[model samples]
Target: MNTQSYMTSYEILVYTGDKRGAGTDSNVSITLFSKNGKQTGKIPLKNSNNKDPFERKQVDKFCVKGDYIGELTKLHIEHDNSGRSSGWFLDKIVVTDIFDPKTQYVATCNQWLAKDEGDRKISRDLTLHKQQTTTQKSNYYKVTVYTGNKSGAGTNSDVSLTLYGNLGEAGPMKLANQEDNFEPGKKDEFTIECQNVGELNQIFIAHNNKGLSAAWFLDSIVIEDLYAMHTYQFPCHRWLAKNEDDGKIARFLVPQSSTTETPQIRKHNQYKVTVFTGNKSGAGTDADVFITLFGNQGQTGQIKLDNEKDNFETGQKDEFIVECPAVGEINKILIEHNNKGLSSGWFLDRILIEDTQGHRTYEFPCNRWLAKDEDDKQIARYLVPRPKVKNNQYKVTVFTGNKSGAGTDADVFITLFGNQGQTGQIKLDNEKDNFETGQKDEFIVECPAVGEINKILIEHNNKGLSS
Candidate 1:
């Protein structure tokens, strides 16, 4: 007696083919896949083409969503002993998704079983959780056959099981012990090689007599497809930086220029750099801008710059580079007027400064630095307090807010309260102003804090207060 097992949300596909010749038997029973690797749900053969010499049978059992256990676990194909003949045979047996069976079959064939002609079985038994018999030996798998409705009943056949890489090609099956326990309609078992089983992508089971395709009783089958998850890099390019507030560039750019010309100077650690002139504010033409790169003891590297004169746009940016000297010391960068053209009276806007002073070379995070003004004035840094999730839930309390701009008078603070308790304050606003905002915001406190919220008080240094 064979018991079938089933899992949730799975469908079983079974194909049954022709029973021709004098000793053909069309009685085949397919089984469900068992969680224990044993056949479970055994369904009887419903459709048949008795008159046709070539008969192919197929059945589909779909389990309800999340009902994986109802899927087939085991299949039992029994040949009637009373009507048995000498030349009974079985052909290719396949189990797969009704929509896609190719991928499953190919993947299984290449991974699990052997690749031989007379040693491979066209039909597979998915009921087995593990390839218990097939993968037992070091480089070989075994197949055991039983007889009739009885466990150990019936006689063994004199035939052998063959393995194949695909359904078309012959040989290359790489199977051995082909003549071991050959049983047809009776209880029998045998082993096959496992070396060249690389092409078995899916689960397939079937049997054949001699070298030709034959029809035999078959049971249940199951298949699974596996995929590898990994991370890979592809080709991509970086975009040019627009301004200091925009973002930082991953790499520096090289400009085309000659030794006689001077280039625009950029501050260290700054992502954005723009230049403008006061003299020729409108008459756009090539102006001589002398750029000097100095190293230790007045030493210098390459003086690279663009040959084309800059038009000095309000927001446009260009690329230029300074090479480091062999000595590797603090290098001073200066930009002067060589030709002193009409637009030589230009001024720098977004002057980013990079730290090339210390012995250790470490580029600062783009957000940490800003351009300097006439008196070397830098932008003020503001802080924004981030709150943690409250333990006592207040579904009504909303914490939507923002921080003020640098130098702006915005006092940032959070007025948190619970129950009838005094309000707790957390400040994140600038000295000049409290906070910035596009619209209004609110928050709700949980039940435990509800009674303490009524006595809420606002604590802030800068900016105004509102209810």
Candidate 2:
């Protein structure tokens, strides 16, 4: 158990000016400073969520880690005018503590980070609110690098890694903890400040290809982003030695979410709900529709389903995505429409729900009319999952040849054979005669599907009299 995991996190919201060309493609950097002279490294600011970032009127969410730096008093921001139209107009910056949202610091820097802008300077230092106080502290990150056990797995070269995420990148941070840092079949741990890299994605690890054992077999790298409370795993399991692995001294390893990896705690979960309408006539509805899901733990608030130019049409599957707090095993769903009066019912065939966090799918079948004048006259219904069949009910049809004595008077039975197994012999009984000449008889039987129907066997008791 690491006590560093309990450190608080700060959220930075950057607003791009609404003016045209206010967005920038250039690299942006920032540093946090306390009035007591404590300051963080110049952390690179990049948002992975936005491919074309810093767009006009856009707000980017980033998490910044603070090392004991209490009551932030100011921050230094700068951007390199690199890419096309890289001029960036600076709006106000709002920083808040994740643990205490009410504790906020507003730095209003209405300037530009462009060569041709106001001061022709690409950097500015903005102070916090006039009423706030400041102090000094620094955040720490625990980095563990593993050396492979293979022959000549250790490296004598200098190893460095840069943390990349939506918030920023902190590094090329040298991995020079001790003289025997990269020893084969060994692990080294070092604690450094990797101030908030929101949603850690990719990591760049490499060596300078120096020393006696410059070619090293790297196993993996693990970094703790206590600000986001996630331990990210960047598995290499390859050679970073120049003479090995395509003779490359560096490897860009992305984060893995395998069973061994610890995922970041998510505040909200997204659900994809698809409502299928019956193919029958008058199956669609014009009024707004809503649904509420009930699970073992709790229930979701009523959410409206609306998408596309037209939705909930006859013989159509209307899909909608909604985000809410995670719930337990889903058991039931409530679906209804606001439409009343004549012929306004919606014939819902079923509803399918998929939960990404739980990796479970739920199906609720309601093959009926949801109208005020139909069924039970109730427009709403609570439908539980009626599928995921443990046993399949198949309607078997038997045709009697149109010839003399073609009908079977004796008790008839059938055993269906499939790839999985075979079903027990089931009696084929009906309301009318068992089977008449030129007549087709249908019977329903329930059994586990043997997979593919390869063959079937039929038998009779040969009892010619009534029971």
Candidate 3:
């Protein structure tokens, strides 16, 4: 036998005949011997429980530690002495390596009827078995990359990635050119189809080197199996620039649980406003500028820029810090200037608003003049709050079946919709949630604010059945 086969485990099948006529118990033993005639291990086969003439029995998963350098050459069987009437018969014997599917028929004997036939012994030659090569199953994965939110700096058309697995390495897959050129605050996905490639271990990202502005600020990457639903997220909070010494960034694809918790609203009580005055047209320097911030709950009082120090002078810029006492999200901002006469209005360039608490910034650009007959310059921008840690709680009772009828045996899904346009869904299994016929289950759902839940929709595996 080869080294691999000798070191592996085996299963032996034996057949023993009934010795009822013989008084003593019918004992059968099969012994193994190396090429040098050294006795190795012995396997005692179980006797037949049935009183039939000949019965076949099997001994599964028998193992023997063999010297890898040597091979087994001989096989011997010994039967205990019986009464004077007759002797036990050895119907057959077969050996198979459990690990080797190709070497299933290691040794076989049709009928080596072993009995004291006038004190004569019978022996049969055994042939060694060889092992065969086998192949393993392959796995597939899908990788998704998300770019960061940096204004015109690191957003480019060329984003490449290299995936490494147990089998081998797979490509420097390039991301397709998107409308935004895979720019900041953009996302793109790539698929990796491989055969016999094990779990994804590491990935290397390369940014575009076409130009200095072609670099990317990568946010995160999500890798998931094509068949499996779980996703692994790798957060990269750094810039991938070709000009840097180390242009490529490598990260381990660590598995992470998907979150279903509600995202918290960002609080922007402290605000910083940077006002840029003057436009390319070179108009309106004498008019006073007025600005107002409107939030979800309330609005900031009208702020006027009348003083010469804070006036909207040509090609001049100023900064202001305003704090809001209201406890809601900022939704809109209005910018207007007094249109007393020609050249009396201000030419607006742009306004930058920063939320100190959330570390979020927004720019409202207006290139035209804020003068007479111009529409009220209202920029309707929604400043979504940063996800805050949730503390509010809710209790939900799911009815598998009511008094009217019982639901079918299937999984149940529930979705909670909030007044703020936030929604969350959870799945419940029939057996896990104890959703038997006419049974109800209660669950505690955690959210950022309990009062935001406007309604809940429940659905079952059955089609078209939802409330």
TM per candidate: 0.20, 0.31, 0.26
Tens-place lDDT per residue, model 3, 63-152, is 333322244555666655443433444444555433332343344444333455523343444454444445433445677778788765
Q: Which candidate leads in lDDT?
A: 2
- For model 2, give the 10-residue run with minimal summed lDDT: 130-139
The best candidate by TM-score is 2
Q: Residue 79: error of model 3 in Å?
A: 44
Per-candidate total of colliding backbone pairs: 115, 5, 3
Q: Model 2: residues >4 Å from true position, as ranges?
A: 1-138, 258-467
Of the candidates numbered 1 and 2, which has the greater TM-score value?
Answer: 2
241-285 per-residue lDDT for model 2 (tens digits) = 667765768665656565545643223456888899999888888
RMSD in angstroms, all models?
Answer: 32.6, 20.1, 31.1
Candidate 3 overall Cα lDDT vs. reference?
Answer: 0.52
lDDT score, candidate 1, position 87:
28
